[model samples]
Target: MSNSLEILQKYWNHDAFRTPQEEIIASVLAAKDTFGLMPTGGGKSITFQVPAMMMEGICLVISPLVALMKDQVENLQNKGIKAICLTGGISSDEIIDLLDNCEFGNYKFLYLSPERLQNDWILERIKNLPINLIAIDEAHCVSQWGNDFRPAYLKIVKLKEYFPKVPFLALTASATKRVQEDIVKLLQLDNPAVFTKSFARENLAYMVFNVEDKLHLMEQILKKNPQPSIIYVNNRKSCSETVTQLESLGFSATYYHGGLSPKDKENHMKLWMNEKVQTIVATNAFGMGIDKANVKTVIHLHIPPNLENYYQEAGRAGRNGEKAFAVLLTNPSDVIHVEAQFLSVLSDKAFLNLVYIKICNYFRIAYGEGIDEKFSFNINHFCTKYSLPILKVYNALQFLDRQGIINLSQEFTEKITLQFIIPSKEVIRYMSLNKQDEEVILTILRTSPGIYESQSVINISLIAKKSNTDENKVLAILHKLNEKGVIELHAKNNDATLTFNEVREDERTINRVAKYLEAQNKLKTDQLKSVLHYIKEEKKCKNKLLLSYFGEVINEDCGVCSYCISKNKTKTDTSTLSEKIIGLLKIQDLNSRDVVKLTKYSKDDVIFVLKNLLENDTIMVKPNNLYSLKN
Candidate 1:
């Protein structure tokens, strides 16, 4: 066998692999199927990358996220490994050509989405390729028990049938015992070697604070930690609002959500990643594939629906093994509010059916038509046209996606492009005539490469910087230029595209998927209850509670968490209580029982304090057992 260490050093510049990475790589290299259950930052990618480089043929990776596939492909190519990812919007001819190159060319890695595997042509072509190993990232998605399960993952089993000799490496960051067993069974691995690193992060402290004002609590936490952090909210409006609120408190903050354009998202991400900003207030779409290692804290402004979601998002902190905190700031009402919002939409059968019909109409698909057709959809437009609630519509769309009736993906495209319509002399002549237009035109020309030759993608923020203005100004100038026939500009758009995976059969199709949707709703409710239970649990060790939820056992309490801190504070203050009782008696006499009831101390502690006070002549008990200070 080829040396994996040499391959790793030559490509990645890493001298050693983290625990179980080397072990997992060795198992795959020895022609054994393996399952790696590592934490969020556990170096799972290198397990396949290093082994695939040392082996002979191509490594086929089936992933679900287009962004993740794109990032990993670019990273591998930068390391001098030939890699390609086949995703949506690519033509059939382009995919065929790419696969043909992979078959003949010495390509080390082929990353493609799971939906791509369902394509008959792609599957047939893949059968002819020289495949050595198969890696399934996010393997838990194959099981219905997982939070992010996708039906497309079920198609992965077909690869094993085609190449019986090839070994499969299934990996997920977080999965329970049930999900792990399901992954092994669903992938049909033959006695695979399993590697499960515990989900416990000893460096991370988990805390939950019930407060009246969540924002106030958040500000306090940020003030103390005051490092690179992520504040996760549930909606786009909340994301922006939180950022605004934080900035009003004199903290450098930015915001991100799925609704932002590609350029805007990139700009905000760079600001946070480069440490130009202290905190990034974002929706759930913020953290995948983001590699900032020094995130000191991750605070959730609202409760997540499941432990898996919380674990993954909170786990983003302290990746560099420093002491960090994951705190959830919520109130009693938040639990009821979140549950009501989700269940109202998710559990409504009639509402979901209406949404399904409306979606078909929105896409102009008649009954029993539009199978496997993709359409660019705007949720706002659909909701406004039908007068439906936006959140409910979104939930229904998600239900369709989980049911395999449709594939909905949000595409944040770099659509900022410009093609000059007027000649260079006219532009200069017009610029000389109009002083207001001169700066914007010059900024565009300087920032965009090949703007004169053809349409080019431009960054609005970079143009703003060069023009000494803002993004709104840059965009306004672009729009004015387009109107004046000086340029044809296409502004950036952040919209979701929906593809009909099956024909629009109306009620029959909805009924077919109704059972699965019902089960999903039940699971979600149970998941929410479990998180609520964790938040309300007081006496249990926070770390031990979380570990036990993920099917692990730990004996000791995490000493630094809020629960332990409070517990310890009460343990070492027996003398302080006596002094407080004597001082209170000096102000006014009170019985021992009344003192215990009125004060926050326990009855036994108050009684102990009264006994010590009487022994030291600090207080005296009258005939009626009323304690009085000595004269």
Candidate 2:
């Protein structure tokens, strides 16, 4: 077998591994189950990919996101390594063929979502393969205590029973001490060797600006960091609004969210990726598979629900090992709303049950009848029909999904797919005979491959550009071709998916799951408290606080963070200055500049002392901008 470094050089073209990666890879190569706790962009994928190549049998990688799985698979294939992923929306026959390829086609890696482990045929087939190593990505999701918990991860433990000798590698970017323990016990790994790296990103400067005008601060940050940047907002509307504001300010920007059509999302991503747009105003859904290394800034316009999310999203800023800024722009009202919105959703049993029943009625699934049935759900349509609150209903659906009551999928199909129903010769003959439709059909054939064999995704705009016509004209021609029985065209759709994991359960039945909901609510509440604590904390180092949350300790503060810099710049201790200012005030009233001159302190320090004194009722700011003792 080739050594890990040799395989890394051969495939990934890297000289060495990041800190704990080499150690973790060595452990896995030694046939020991390993657990890696590293931050995002920590090169966790290499730990498994390199070792899997060194081993003899196929490496079964169980991941959560379909886009992530597909991306890794495509990346491996581009490197000439045989890889396949069993993702959603594939037929049983296709799954069988794919698994067979893994078994017999000398494939090195096989990727699958945790939900696919429940299939009997998949399990039967997997039991026979020469499985080498099992790697779990986003392993924190297995713990109910962790963020992004998915109950389907429970099925992963059964793999231990089937492949007793196979070593397991569990990897995640962020997990608390409790979540780490839960991952070990739930995955049933046998005495796994654990490797943890500090969550501190020294290159990333964390800043929180409490500004009355957030848009102004955002504009200033964008102006300072003219490189590629991401501005995260709380909702889709904010994304569009931010983009509009940036464009109005002469910044090339675009927006992305879950609500956008697949085509629009693609166009937005392509524009950002190609640097045609300098900034992308987006919700949290924008960063999963994105790897633009030179991203100079990541600004959060609205506070995230938790610090874990905040850390993960902000960590995207400095992947190139260069200094970058991760800023959170908020006001007092924003913080209040963040807390209020979370409180409204926590442990609302009635609301959750209402959503559950409405979803059942929406699908016409009578109680106790719809088991394991999946439907293409449109939240807008359902909300309009039932007059339900969209945000609450959406949160309730997410709560149900986490409880394993139902599977709500937001990864919608975004590509325009087409396949020729008639023979290629017949298509050619039709195109030749029909001169008006010839250019569009020929452009479709040239732009997208495999259309003759199977349905392949096509870019309508690209087709239009190639055909020298508009998108509507190209789409109309494709529709005409569908009518003529020459092809089958599938347009991009943004509908979400709702899968009924079990029969429709009543409120009483759902009450059992309510306990899980209660637990989840408590988890969310705790996470929100952490966010509030992070925001309110003034004395502690920001980097130290973040590292401490993930159970790591640092002896020295990251002196480069905003808090540290401010701490360094303030020469006069606030307590001493407050005392001097209050004593001076008791003697006689003094103006703001006069107080600064008497104390020999900067204007900011003087102002800080006066504000403290005012809050304590020791002094007051009069209309003349003078400080006076208050009774």
Candidate 3:
């Protein structure tokens, strides 16, 4: 009864633990290093969460995302388990109270970002606290090879050095072979037991549509299956736009993104989870750490950053062992736009230096002095003070962070600059097109440094004021320069930041390291999109496509995916999976999750398969899924 199976049944009502879950959870309980490679919706959190509940001491979970931490903590609390999260967006006093509660309370779990580990004040108190185990979420980010690598998350591995007796568990939804090795090595796991569940989803179909009328297509698809759904878009603007369109068609939909205020975000999430909202349109920011089971469908308005991202996003649907749909709406032209958006973060050396200079001037902090200061930025104010094009300036600021020139925290500041190349005499060429054009150009230039000097990183907004011109007009001119190559344009490459072990090198060495990384990063970007292209191709089963691409071969096709559905477009499945039937189910009668495990399939493959099986009467689900051999 105390083993993994009983644990799954008593507190949680599942009949059996999946292939990797028992092994992974057992390793954690036995005080051994563990690595788990479960695809999304693989019940990954439960593997750690259940064992943590049984352990004597608190399971300190190190997570990279603050929002994800909060979500996990909230879920545990809802289950009537004890948990707390430490993060900066909340008050310091509240954190102190929470830690204090943990010190004496029955706190079974403590969720936090790795950045919290660097807080000396918190570390002093936490060092004495008895930690039974440690779990790292999104463990792949610990690796430089991972798509969204973070320097801070890498610190989780060093926790072993501190609490060497406690076991470590690293969990991730997706990671390439290289990324997996890096995660294990970086964490310094000692011959850790690796648990890899099959990465196939047999019931959910894989689909890629090349269409011009994405919105119209989305409407048609929604019509085909009216159920609880999610619509994923790439940007906040698109989230709002999609939600509006969905609502216009009488679908009760809501939108979620980073731009929404915290209260509004919470409200929107509650609505979605409660089934009050039939569809939720959102960006990649929406689904992390959200566990709304029974999501009937997931639609992507734009192609995702990579296959890992897309797989995870699509996996959100059909968590309840029911049939679900995942669709991607894309156009060929979208490739150019997505590529540009990604490459915007990777800037030339000169552009990076410009940003570092601007950041220093914006905060009025000298180099090496702005390590951890807090500032909230105003883009309009920044544009006016620097007279720089707001877009390029924004991109450059991001690049500075990428270059490790400055720490762009969850904070922002307002300052601006204008280059002096287009002198007043020559500025007349672009002027009079707008009333504030000439004055705006002069003002921005005055507040900021000249683009020609390359050393004068100035504030654009303040300069706009000095020259008595419009910030918008100033931004227009700066964009014009970037367009005209009047000055070098800067942009952000991807969502990745550096992950260093320590600051062993000095400033010069850091620059050398960054430049090397910059080059390697470019190579990674150049090859990443091709992986996504494979996912979109119509040639193979989605899961097989990924495995073959990664050099992992499967002998048989998982006859349940977008490709399979199209090939067998004659039938539709309606039977739902159940637990009782699953328990009575022996070899020939596998429910969705069982088939997934038995076949060693991915989420996409399994979903597609179950849908096909149900349609063909290849599998039958009675009440409680007592799937007696069906033919």
Candidate 4:
């Protein structure tokens, strides 16, 4: 068998391993359970991939993210390694065939979600495979104390019953001491060799600012950095609005969110990655599995839900070890806003049970039935019909999904099916009369043939593109045609796809996962409180605060952070600050805010110097409150 370094060189084309990766790989190869706590962008995949390449049999890799699993499997396949990922939407026959390939076709890696292990048939098939290593990615999900806890991850430990001697490798980028201990105990990792890389990012400067005008501050930051960067917002509307705002200010930018189509997401990411765009304005959905090394800055328009999320998102910058910045812009009201957004929407056990029963009833599923049944779900319509709060219901659905009761797919598309009632010649006459709708009608007719004979699904976006119009216009034209009896249009606004992963047991099904839901809600509340504290904190070093939260203690403060810089500014002599303010006033009359901006000093110091100057007549305040130098 090839050694780990030889395998890494042969496949990854890397000359040597990064720090701690070689050690983790050695432990895994020694047939011992291993746990690796590395920071984001720390090359965690190398430790498992290199050793798995040298192993004798196939490696069973369990991950919580379907997109991550697919991406990793594709990447390995591109490197001429045999790999397969089993996610939702695949048929049983397809799964059996894939497993057969893993067993007999010399496949090296079988990446699957933790929820898949709950399937008895899949588990039985997996038991027959010659597994070499059981690798768990995002292992923190197994811990209730972690920021993102998924109860389905607990099922991953059942694999140990089948492969008792097979070594397990659990890896995560963000996990505290409590979370690490939970991962070890819950995953049944037997006396695992743990490797932790310090969470301190030496080259990254953490900054927090309370600003009145966040957009203006963001623009100033972008101008100062002017390199590849990511601006994270909390919602889809903000992503698009921020991009438009940045573009109007003469900057190149694009937006990313879960609502965007896959093609659009990929295209936007490519534009940012290839330097065709200077920045990517995105929601939190944009950054998993992304490896861009030259990001000079990462700015958050609003505070994140937790420090773990903030650290991971901020750590995306300066991966190449050069100087970079992580900035958070917030105001006093943001505390209440964040709580309303994240905390208020948390669903309790009773709410989850209600949602579960209502959904099953809506779908007309009988009790103890409805396994593997899928439906197109419109959350707005469902909530309206049941008279429930949209945010709370959405949260409940997400919780059910995490518990493996249902597979919620938020990538939804509008389904439009239409059939023309009028003859082709009469349709021409109608279009001639309604000239404004002529192009959309013609485009739809040309793109969707046989519309007069039978109903057919049409792509509204495609029709809009072909006619050089927008989707809204096309939809309006279709509705007008339908109203005129020219066509029979059926349109359903589907924003998600729901698949029942388990039988409908109503309250019993919910009761089984009630403890987890309660714990998760409590965890979320605690995390939000921590986030608020971090934002309000002023005395501690920003980097040290973040590191300490992650269970790492460091003596020295990161001198580049906002707190350190402010602390240094307070040490400057008052006379020196007054001299700088006088020099600025001599150039031109300026206000206190502008003086602070120009001098790069703390606001209090600038204000203090301005007060002294005004009292001593060194500088005089004009009518408009602008300070001017005395002649």
Candidate 5:
């Protein structure tokens, strides 16, 4: 085998790199600042991994998600690459020790979250490592112009300042042209070449299902695409509730979200990755850096916040190059729910000032001085007490953070409730009269909030396991009873998640701030419009559209998109895919480039045939960076 093929076989055990991968790898190895606009499952990690293995020094990869960092490090170690990450769960002393290992130890890849970049000891920790390349995953987060702008990303500029000779490789599955430019400018890359691969997935069908009952809908979708799948819900409550429903239906599944204990999240995720579990019902927080290539489908329990989010979540399916499907389940009310959320974000300056005051009053302390005291907040209760809009209040809090008022650490807590308010006999009579509804009635009573003085902290799992029902049923039945006005629903200490801009702007400042907020609101609305555009785009192949969104322009169609497939069905008549391969290669080599080179045939035809050949072991990509006939 030739050098590239030997490296491929030795480490990744693949026949050859995907299209554009060779060029990308070559650029990075040559010490050029490289930007890769590859689609989901396009081997973006491999581009950096190969170069990291080839280079003599360590490659520092800055990622936003800790779970993604952990998974990638484990996967690399599994492949015999030395890798590690310094995340928050560890102590500072442990961090010092880990840094010791990295500095003198035989480690090639070191991953760190951008937040850690600002840590006082981090620069001290890595002041002397033989670092070579700096790979920034989720590069869009660096740009304020993108959907998830993280201020921590700005700290990455320190990399170039600290180590001027190190090359940079920024990789992201989804980004807009503006975000790509921002990443390049932010990272201070000196004239980087963006290698973009097509985003079209012919094997993964894009479809949506409208369902009133999400639990029933989840089971139906799971049964259809039974292979390992991911089900994304908007909240942690929904994630756990859906997992319970899936488990009740006898599908072994798990759940993950920012809400779960880190240990629980880690254990449950391992089960799915290890194939001990077949499904994971989770919030959008799950599934980054997940490289399980055989995921069959991804079901969105509700509409995603934006097309960028939806596309990234959906793209998780069919990664093994096999046929897969991605479906979205939407209810009409979902739009209203989302709109309500967005509108609530428009809290007036008074609400912000009021909440800021309450926050200060609650702490009996002002901002910049509460580092030692822990805060637990329920926006609903807080707003109710203050007669403020919860959504607007929430936005005020975020804006305050933007204004440098408070520190909102990433922490979540569970809420529990008691079921009925009536006496036992009265409840018995109600159940007796509605004998057919006993199970449903019992569910409402048991899962009902307020057992502790008619209210308990959130403990749906304990209730469900005891009552032999799932959280979804518990919630659904409770809603049914509440609809009939049988009992009231009261929650307490809701959603402990909090963020603080370092200082609260006083109420006296609102009239002066109104004009500025109006402009910010318009900017936010425009961002939402861009999100809608990503969703409604149907003209270009999905892959090409996604790549171009990241500012990488592929001159030819991917030939492997769903649109290409449907078109090929109507236009071409062939007995075998080999004939199609020959037709494609007649115009060019059978490399990933040749597959991408054709402007004539549908990309769906080219990719579908390529997959078939790979599966049957008919055609093989060999050494010397070329494809050839094999028997």
Candidate 6:
């Protein structure tokens, strides 16, 4: 077997492992159950991937993120390593072939979602493979107390029943002490060797500011940094709006959200990655598997749902060990808005059951049926049809998804079926009579040849391009043809797809998972409260607060965070700072930055003294938008 370093150098081109990574890899190599706790950018994947390379047989990886799984698999394949990922949308036959390939086709890695372990057929097949190691990514999900708990992760323990002697390596980026204990116990890792890296990023500065104008503050932060950066907003609408706002402020920016098409997401991501754009404004969906090392700033427009999420997102910056800033720009309204957005949408068992029944009926699935059946689901149409609140329904669907009752995929797609009721000759004659619709009709005829015989799926965008028109115009033409009895048009827009993983037993299904649903809701409430406290508490150092929340203790202040800077400023007499600011204003009108630069004081101290002067009517702003002495 090759040495771990040799494999790392061969595949990843890294000369040495990060601190404690080599130790964790050695533990896994020794065939012992191991647990590794590292920060988000601590190269957790290296611990498992390097060791797995030196082992004899293929390594089995269990991860909760399908996108991440695919990304790792693609990365490994690009490095000339054989890897396969089993996610949703695969047929049983294809899965069987894939498993067979793992068994004999010299494959080295197979990544599966935890939900896949629930299938007896897949588990039996996995038991027969020459599995040398079991690695669980995001291992904290096994704990109910963790930030993002998935009940499906609890089923991962069953793997032990299949391969009792195979070593297990559990890895997570963020887990508190309580969550850490839960993971070891729940995964049944027998006396696992634990390795934990300190949760402190020495070069990263954490800053939180209460600002009424968040966009203006964001502009100032970007202008100051002027490097690769990310701005995280809460929703899809905010992603585009923030990008637009940044562009208007003379910054090159792009937007990314879950709602964007796959091609668009890739294009936008490349724009930011290649440095063609200075910043990427995105929702939380944008950062998984991202490997940019020089992100100078990661600014949050609002408080994140939980500190775990915030830490992971903020950690995306400064991977190169350079000084980077994680700034949270918030206002008084943010707390109320976050609560309304997350807490108010908590659905109980009864609500979940109601949603379940409505969905089954909406898809016309009878009880004792619907297992393995898939449907194109339009959430807005379903909510409007059932007169249910969209957010509540969405939360309930997510819960149901976590429980393995159904699989919900949020990939947006459009399905259109078209058939011509009229004969082809009659259609051509009718099109000739309508000169405006002739091009679209001919394009559709050329594109969809079988539409005259049966309803066939057609590409509207392609037809639009071929006809020298837009999609809306082509759709209008199709509707016109349908109204005139020339063609049969059936078009449905789907933002999500739903697949039933279990038979529909109505309330009984929801009852089985009622306790979990309640616990999850309570967990969300607690997480939000902690977020509020983290943001509101002003006495302690922000870095210490974040590290302490993750069950780490630091004796010295980071001296770079917002609280530490303010604390240092308080040591100097405020009156002295105010007099210095007054001195600067006495010379000429100055803005806050000018005051800070000229006085050689921190921005926080300068802003503090300026506020005091303004309150005392000792200074005033002239038409030039700079501080001036009141005359």
In candidate 2, what are the lDDT values of residues 451-564, reduced to their tens digit? Answer: 786566666656776788887898788888889899888876656888886788778657877766777788888998888888768788888888888888999989987678
Cα RMSD of predicted structure 1:
12.6
lDDT of 5 by residue, 1-631 (tens): 2455567779888988888888988888788999998877677778887877877889888887666788889888998888989865456688888888899888999998777777656786776889988888888777766666667688888878778878889888777777778889998888898876656676777654333455665776678777899988877767756776778898998888865667777899999988798898888778776778899988887767566677788989988879887776654345335555665677555666677778777666664454324466655455545566644666676655443245453444455444456666776787788665577556545654334233334454444555666667766766665566565655433356454323433564445455545555665666555544443443555556555555557766655554444545664443355675766655545554355454345444554565567558766555433455664
lDDT of each: 0.83, 0.83, 0.67, 0.87, 0.68, 0.86
- Model 1 lDDT, residue 314, Cα: 94
RMSD (Cα, Å) for all candidates, in order, is: 12.6, 12.7, 15.8, 9.4, 15.1, 9.9
Candidate 1: the clashing residue pairs are: none
- Give a tens-digit lDDT track for model 6, residues 222-326: 889999999998877577567767878999999888766788889999999999999999888889889899999999997888999999999999999999999
Output the worst ten-in-a-row residue range by lDDT, candidate 4: 330-339
Give every collision pair in model 6.
Answer: none
For model 1, residues 1-631, the per-residue Cα lDDT tens digits are 5598888888888898888899999899899999999978888899999999888899999888787898899999898789999977677789888998899999999999888887788899999989999999999899888777777898899988899999999999888888899999999999999998988888898988764457766887899998899999987657766877888888899989876777788999999999999999998888878878899999998888899889989999999899999998875457547777767666467788899898998879988799779888767556756778877788888877756688888653444778898889998998999898688789887766567766666756556666777768778878888999999888756568888878888889888767667667777888888888888787787888888877898888889776786677655377787777877887888865567666789754675566567678878756544688999
Task: Give the residue spans of candidate 2 off by over 4 A.
Answer: 411-493, 507-509, 570-631
lDDT of 3 by residue, 525-621 (tens): 8555765566456667766886654446787666766676566565423223323233335545544545545655443444554445555675665
TM-score sort, best first: 4, 6, 2, 1, 3, 5
On the 0 to 100 scale, the lDDT of residue 445 in model 6 is 82
- Candidate 5 lDDT: 0.68
Residue-level lDDT for 134 in candidate 2: 96
Reference-based TM-score of each model? 0.78, 0.78, 0.70, 0.82, 0.66, 0.81
Residue 443 of model 4, lDDT score: 91
Give the per-residue lDDT of model 4 (tens digit) for 1-631.
Answer: 8888899889989898888999999999899999999989988888888888887889998887887888889899999999999998788899999999999999999999888998998999999999999999999999989877888898999988899999999999999899999999999999999999999899999998864457777888889989999999987657766887899899999988876668878999999999999999998888888999999999999888889999999999999999999999875357546787786788888888889999999999999999999888877557756778877897899888888899998674436779999899999999899999999999988987768866666767567777988878988989889999999998756568899999999989988999998898888888888888887777899998899899899999889998888788737689888878887787899866688889998765775567678669898766555778988
Error of 3 at 364 (Å): 1.3
